[model samples]
Target chain A: MITIFGKPLLLLYGQLTLGLINGAFYALLSLGLAVIFGLLNIINFAHGALFMLGGFVAWALLEYLDIGYWPALVLAPLIVGVFGVVMEKTLINRLYKLDHLYGLLLTFGCALIIEGLARNEFGSSGVPYPIPDELRGPLDLGFMMLPAYRAWVVVAAAGVCLATWLVIEKTRIGSTLRAATENAPLVQAFGVNVPRLITLTYGAGVALAAFAGVLAAPIYSVNPNMGANFIITVFAVVVIGGMGSILGSIVTGFGLGILEGLTKVYYPQASATVVFMVMVIVLLARPAGLFGKA
Target chain B: MPMSRRALLATAAATALPVRPARAEKPTLKIGVLTDLSGPYKDLAGPGAVDAARMAVEESGLAAKGINIEVLSANHQNKADVGASVAREWYDRDGVDIILEVANSGVALAVAGVTKEKNKVYINSGAATSDLTGAQCNANTIHWVYDTYMLAHSTGAAMVKTGGDSWFLIVADYAFGHALQRDSTDFVQKAGGTVLGAVRYPFPSTTDFSSFLVQGQASGAKVLGLASAGTDVINLIKQAHEFGIKMRIAGLLIFLTDVHSLGLEVSQGLTLTESFYWDLNADTRRFADKFARRQPGRRPTMVHAGVYSSGLHYLKTVGDMGLAQARADGAATVARMKATPTSDDCFGPGSIRADGRKLCPAYLFEVKKPSESKGPWDYYKLLATTPADEAFRPLSASACPLVKA
Candidate 1:
């Protein structure tokens, strides 16, 4: 059996671990996407650009100012969040009452403009962000050697994903936000300042993407086009997980990453297209996703 | 007698004064810098090539002459169709006399076809496929800079010679990756290495490589060659580290830009072959220093360096004569460049081969350990220098139609 399978157990475990790491990013990005989709009902094509901007912000902080990772972590999200707020107020809000497609289009245009400006300014080559001193080395875990930074990324992303889910699922503010999303007129009658809440919500969602970007900067090259590369995969992940459920998105994100990892081991050629292929299968078999509320 | 002498002088002046000055109209030489200005390949070509072109113009002092030179640029978006259309437009309408820096192989091939049709010149520095000079070779196109055959021969053959044979390839499932794998395999086998096994990863894949690494680890091959670049290279290295597949991993064609991006931790101890390094020699240092003054903190890539050399050669030819004369004098100009021991700010004293490949010494470099000290960008330790003759695929081995003919 072992001879026929060629170390199937080890391969599967390795693939799953890889999948979980990828899923962590997927979960974080999709969670943000879901939050925005739930309220704004816009695709937010610029989400990836914002994520890339977050990474660039972190890189700039380190490269130009000698600010460490801890500070950059806090500063990058805040800076990106502010940009998000400006983007929402100046551009996104204008398209709210119009066709939802306009919001998508506007965000898409904003994404192109942002990516173009960054590429023009920085060029397409990736800039390196040093791993923080605290998370520089590898930790031996019997079967595998895990880099402290990658492990941190997986954990930190999960923590953020869970905390966001908790906030949305529980708490009075969460209920009010949900109410606004379902029926903004009623929430406004309750004197909740629904418009302000919506604006903040969009900003918060963008902030999540930026946060992920900041985490990814040290691991991946801080390139202008970094977000564009992963955004399509995240969209496919969101589709597979079903955009309707937050938890589903999280599970699917991590789940697919592992599946992709396994594909790499067993059938390397199909590794790249496996996720999209899975998305197709899920859409055909269970349209609402595995953990979705259908 | 005085009146007669004055008449004679007036007659001499009248004969000396030229009648057809309009026939010697200053020729405007249009050179197209086809680069990815706003796409994934942009950093690899784009503005850097533009800057190189400007440097060439300045270095050649072409503007000082009566010749008028103009440079135009476009982004092909890594698509052959787009590149073809742009090349056609530039050739037919825009009067682009020469096209340089077609980055993507697909795009390069497309532009090569168009240049052939238009009877224009192409100096390809960006594309990696040897097929441009091989099966796809055209009289109008010159494959400058490095190609897959050079990379495969330099890295693969060198590794095999050093006894790091028995290969496992983690190839990107694309034309570029496939060709690289095929070419490298031939060199590996010829150098007395065995191909243990191989696998292909999808292009632009965003996932962990734990599985692929495990398969490679299980292959038991002394060398695991990564036939990929950019994000795939980054992810593979990182994931390979995680999976503990650190022994004898080889990057067939990794850019210094990629090494800079990956940093020391991910890139450390990995060996790769490169035609140009910023810190190669005194001339390179001078060129890189000047480049840094403009770019500020970023290093000049090989493609950028190639652009400067090719552009300068073009301008020099045009300056010596006119655009038509320069184009006609291609062989002579190329020979002159080869005859002169070429020294530049980027690569010092590299010779251009007859087959249009730049024959500079390649370096086998190992990524420096984090503790090796220094600071950021202090990444590589020169393991061995493969000389110009030894570094590239021999003329006899080249399938380039030009070489065969």
Candidate 2:
């Protein structure tokens, strides 16, 4: 309840943390988008829908099979990743020889069909997913109380994002993967099995989205329209972060989330629009984006 | 005198095609339940509303009277243009006599305009905008259930009396949200309370409301007003509870369905205003019990109850007037409907006003605590009842031309 000019600093910290929590999601989601776009040279327009599907899968596992949250956290991503593999092999693999727009359109259409089917089955008032029993209460800081689950979301998301960055940047497998993106035929000539790598990369990218979805289920109720709500804002995050830079995506996601939170406290009404405004400003100023290579 | 055989044959064939008679037996009246069956309002009004109407028609025994009634339904998808188009097709091509259960205010208003132009009746049970009977009022539309004004007035006045003085609002940014804010602000001010601060979130888009809640919490207001409905209201309440906001939350428009979605643990002690509650009395419970048999595991919200009440009243009026006469003139049918008293097991005895607002008592309900052990769907405890005359805006205050005339 620390007040500066009648504005509570605790309230400000709470909002910033909330923003950071949202940014954690943004960071995770944009990282997946950037990763998929980097190797596949195609935007996974269905990434958001996959994220939503992850939540439903987790919910279904809990509701139907009596499986708990901890297992579903791991299982949901694996299931969605396999689904992404199948999608890449059967549908998306054919479009690689065509224009990039075909890939975009094909994935966009896939997203719509998936969302429609989910809506038809679930009907849109979201089913609530309760917080895990251990994480039910809030942490009592001297100044303010923060929900334990939300704090975990930020910390866990940052860990995952950093781990993903390290896997791509400092590993031997990452070099080969980057090489395949630059020259698939050359990489294949070097006996790297580039086509299989492409499929697996897409799967991994989609799995990242599903992972975020599982994390998000308890925060936002599981609903068909959940993905559509964040997809546009996430796209803005990707654009501002640069489409192919992993670190850039993570930084930009968290930064914009915090900025949006600050805006909510200071101006309130412009919070939703602020992220997109920053996107526009960034695009106009640096066409290649903050971390994008020309 | 020498008429050709070809001419005689042509005249005979023309008469064989069956000319429509100037005076015919009464045709079946078609009622369309156009509402959101797939979007956010689906659980609030969707198929339950349709089932409620069917139940009303079944109970009316109109079939025994040699009067046939048909119920047609479609999913409006919560879009205004789509609702307008559905209303047009129902009225013009399908011969649907009246439309009911319009849920979204934007869509409801659009359908209201369509009804006016097409000379058809629209009984709005799900939408909550007073403008339907106020500035945007039409001769062809009856705002059957609750409206934002009634809710704001009931909830605001009650909270103010209970010592929740200053307020902050997290409003959904839309027509319905704006109307609720405006109406509630007026009531709060009149009750000698002040609105400290407020924020508007994009309707249905901002799934996260933590920032908004923090702002409200920081406002140091005694009461926090949730001027949103459906999942938005449910989510905000759950988050606020987790954050441990000490302010008394006044939920302006919360349906029973929302409470059911959020269990008693999170929803307990929430004060809201509703026109009808299933567990209110014997009549309401009886109707609700019967509705449960049809829906199976789902309880009736006020909107669902509104559909039944309005549907039954409409059928009774049509039966008395004869379907043919009712269909011949839409305005006259509506006028006759206004003249009749609205009595059903759901709402009990009520009546419609000149501005097409259905007059009924509204109740202030507090959600039952978890320790108050009860069976499923046992949610509310009645706190106060605002009588029919005081529950809504006065006719003299309405900007409707019909009210003025």
Candidate 3:
């Protein structure tokens, strides 16, 4: 008979792989949210709906224009980003001077309208999105099988996160964006076009979310409720990682996912609540979070 | 006589003539169709159930009998409070006499409580928890269509009898999954099987199932039982295939909708038990044809079919005896339903069990091979039939308070 510890190690590796896939999604979504929050200081409650829109756009592109995954990966984010730019200009820009909670409420209303429209059009049943032929099969690890699409998601997500971090930290234009985040008026006085920068930043954030949605379409069901279900957990992830830290969000997202996977292997009942429990403990011990700056 | 006096005398004579009493308006029997119109179960029950209720009304000819069948719907959003409030509003203000097609068990159980309080009849066709008929049994609520017990009995018992005795469970971590796993395990053990071990999975989990599949493979169980439904089932099956856990797998509570969603590539050769299949019999075929006309290329799910059958019977009862009297005498109406052989487009000649679970032959279906070369919707080939007697839990085994009474 196999010992409990002996089986759990193999089980832990399996869960970690699964957790990493989920963490990839969390990292992508939170990275976008962090970018938007850094400049705008308004939590985009409609982020989930925007992610859902990305999937819908991909589905529509496939159904209407015979567009496939490669084009959709490029097209969905661009289209959704344009919409986000318009949203920032028309609706979100007006609430910048008010309490941050007002912006949250406004975004919440927008989310409702978007989700309601999707529900009306698609009904509740999810439509299947076929995986691209290249990403269809599994890679046989000696101990476990790895899905090609899932492995791609992890690699692509890490690439996106690192790219975003490097651009913000190293580039001159990124320094201007950071300066605008600190004081928009001061940056504007220096001819930085802070408002336009803010709008572009918001659009970029939304585009990232859409990109994640495109990545997730083949893995999960493309349904209206898909984003709403995941957004809450992402919010918890963001909170636990601290909203301000870009690298913190990415690291915590992936780490927590592996932790959740391990819990599923050893104690499955607590898998759902384990992340939340970790969040609570972090809040009590170190409110700034592990990677968060004080 | 004078001219004016003669005119008055004629008018008085006309007024004095006897007139026939105005025909009494037939009492309208209000039926409320409550379901999750905008929640997780919406696709399963939402418009499909409403369409089912409409079909039942048309079939029963209740409109011709001066029975006003008013169908009211609401989106409960899977909240017990919203469901109960809707039931109350329908009962108190809308004059709703019967509530049908509640999908969420939490909402269904709450609505059952409200129906009991209001003395209105509830025909539950959507909720799967067996407790509505068990500990929470109400005199006015009937557990229609399917429940956890039926699912466990048919799938688990049948597997055990076939000598696939040892069991491992991949259960969703919730009340529904827990009940399904527990009930099915009991049946497995009673049929001379051993439950090796079980694993709980969180609801809406999107990660890989390699870990859980590995656990099941290590358990050394001959049969791996999945106690979750919908996308969870799809993911589990897909992962199980990828991991190559070739144990005899059984889905304890899979629906035709689940099978359709999964398609043959993933679901092929899997054994599942279902009370109704669109291709089962001539009567079912006819019903599917009519249902397809309304929904356009979608066969009615068992729950949708259940709504139609339960609604038709309820209307028949209302037509035979008035709504007030039907509510006053619950058992008599159920007795009438049992005595009468029900023939519908969905299921033919089905009867109601004493425990209120509709009795019909359930089929163990194996997903057809890819080479079967049939058109769309030609998914399953029937394996074996569990006759009505063996299809559901026996009344003696049911712990429903009413059964003991």
Among the numbered candidates, top lDDT falls to 2
Per-residue error for A179 in candidate 2, Å, reads 1.8
Q: Taking the tens digit of each residue's C-alpha lDDT, what string does model 2 give over A1-294?
A: 567666678777777788898999999999999999888888889988999999999999999998888999999999999999999999999988889899899999999999889987876767777788888888986556788999999998999999989988899889889989988889899999888999999999999999999999887768888898899999899889888899999999999999988887777667788998998899999887888876
Give DockQ per model, in order. Answer: 0.40, 0.54, 0.32
Task: Single out the weakest 10-residue window by summed lDDT for candidate 1 chain B.
Answer: B329-338
Best by TM-score: 2
Model 1, residue B110: distance off in Å is 1.2
TM-score of chain B of 2: 0.93
Q: What fraction of the correct interface contacts does each predicted structure contain?
A: 0.63, 0.63, 0.35
| lDDT digits (tens) for residues A1-294 of candidate 3 | 334676545555666788888889988998888788777888998999999899889988998999999899989999999999999999999988899899999998999899888887776656667678898777776556777877898999999999998888889988999898888889889888888998999999999999998988877667787788778778778878887678888888898878877787778878778988999999898888776767
List the lowest-lDDT window of 10 residues for candidate 3 chain A: A1-10
Query: How many backbone overlaps does candidate 2 show?
Result: 0
Instruction: Go through the candidates in order and give each one's C-alpha lDDT.
Output: 0.80, 0.89, 0.81
True contacts kept of 1: 0.63
Displacement of the residue B322 alpha carbon in candidate 2, Å: 1.0
> By DockQ thresholds, what CAPRI class is model 2?
medium
Ranking by DockQ: 2, 1, 3
